[model samples]
Target: MRSLLMVSAGVAMLGLTAPAAAQNMPAPMHMMPHDGTLLTVVAEGRTTRTPDLATIRAGVTTQAATAAEALAQNSTRMERVLAALRRAGVAERDIQTASIQLNPQYRYQENEPPVITGYQAVNMVSVRFRDVAKSGSILDVLVREGANNINGPSLSLDDPAAALDEARRDAVARAAARAQLYASAAGLSVDRIVSISETMEGAGPQPPMMVSARAQSESADTAIVPGEQDVTVTLTFRFLLK
Candidate 1:
């Protein structure tokens, strides 16, 4: 009987401890629903700025009865042009030889093989000018120094980061404004930003201006107009709906 009483007391003690342990256990977590609605919108922003740098292509074209004569004349003329550019403040690093070519000139007669008349030689160089205002005077000097073939005054900005940043800000603002408009129309509120992405489009240096060679008397300072260039950015934004 005493042994039976001890076992019964032990069973009662175990039943009391079971409820206490159950009360001390952590509660299960409740997960939020993942089926919320997503709203996305795209917006674009653009900014215009004037170019600050110019690139000019200048060269000499010579024709003579012999290849050696043509090449020699072209070389001498190009040397004078390089000296003039240096005197006008163009650095050696900014001048680069773009092309050198020697070809035979052909004269065609009716019902006969083409006759070689003379040899033509061309030597071209590309020059970068940091000062836009000096481009015209430099071209005049180049023409005076025997640059017969002159083309281009390509204009561009040295740095476009600031303009691009401004465009990005404008894009984000436009996206937010459009999102708010949609949210108000649907009687919903934007709770948070889910994601953002960007696309850069139509942002590059302006097209180059072409200048043809003219007679020395007619060749005044080459007029250069550095027009405005556009910087554009597009943004796609996703906002959570509430």
Candidate 2:
């Protein structure tokens, strides 16, 4: 009889302690409902400024009876162009050979066979000028120094890291402000930020000079105008519902 009474008391104690343990621990997944709505908010910020760097593609094209002759002529003209660029205050490191090609020119006819006229050689170089005021003058010098083809003079930002950092900060601040507004409207307080993701879209490069315009130059100096470039950042935020 005593053993039976002790067993009953032990079972009673376990029953009381079980409820306390369950209260302290999280409930099982089956007892909970997955009906809570998730809210996502996004914010965007932008900054604009005029580009400071100028990128130009200048090259020399040469035609001769033989491929070797054409290449040699192209090389000489390219050397002269590089020398002129250096004299115009463009650094050696800033100038790079973008392309070099040597191909035989063929004449096409209606019923006759194709004939090889001469070998055509091309040497292209890409140049970056930090000084925008001298961009036109540099092109003028390049043209006089044997640059036959001017493919582009696309302008861009030289140091965008600082601007991008500012834009990111602005985006985060905007996201937080929007999140708070939504949380207040829904009769809930934003407890904490769950996650944040950001996307940055860079500005488009400036327009390139037309090939036709490049081939025919009546003026002594080429004119270039660089406008403002826009930098934007978009941020997505997820906040815990309180």
lDDT tens readout by residue for model 1, 33-120: 1333345566788888888888888999999999999999999999999999999999999999999999999999999999999999
What would you estimate as the lDDT of candidate 2?
A: 0.71
Give the per-residue lDDT of model 2 (tens digit) for 1-242. Answer: 00000011112111223334335324463432232223356677788878888888889999999999999999998999999999998988899989999999999999999999999999998999898878887787777788888876788888888778878888888767866766566666666665677888775467666543354355576666777788788877655445
> Which regions of candidate 2 fall more than 4 Å away from where they truly are?
1-37, 111-113, 203-216
Q: How accurate locally, in lDDT, is each candidate? A: 0.74, 0.71
Compute the lDDT of residue 167 as modeled in candidate 2.
81
**Candidate 1: regions farther than 4 A off:** 1-33, 215-219
TM-score of each: 0.78, 0.78
Question: What shift in Å separates residue 218 of candidate 2 from its native position after superposition?
Answer: 2.2
Candidate 2 root-mean-square deviation in Å: 14.1
Clashes of each: 0, 0
Clashing pairs in 1: none
Worst 10-residue lDDT window for candidate 2 reads: 1-10
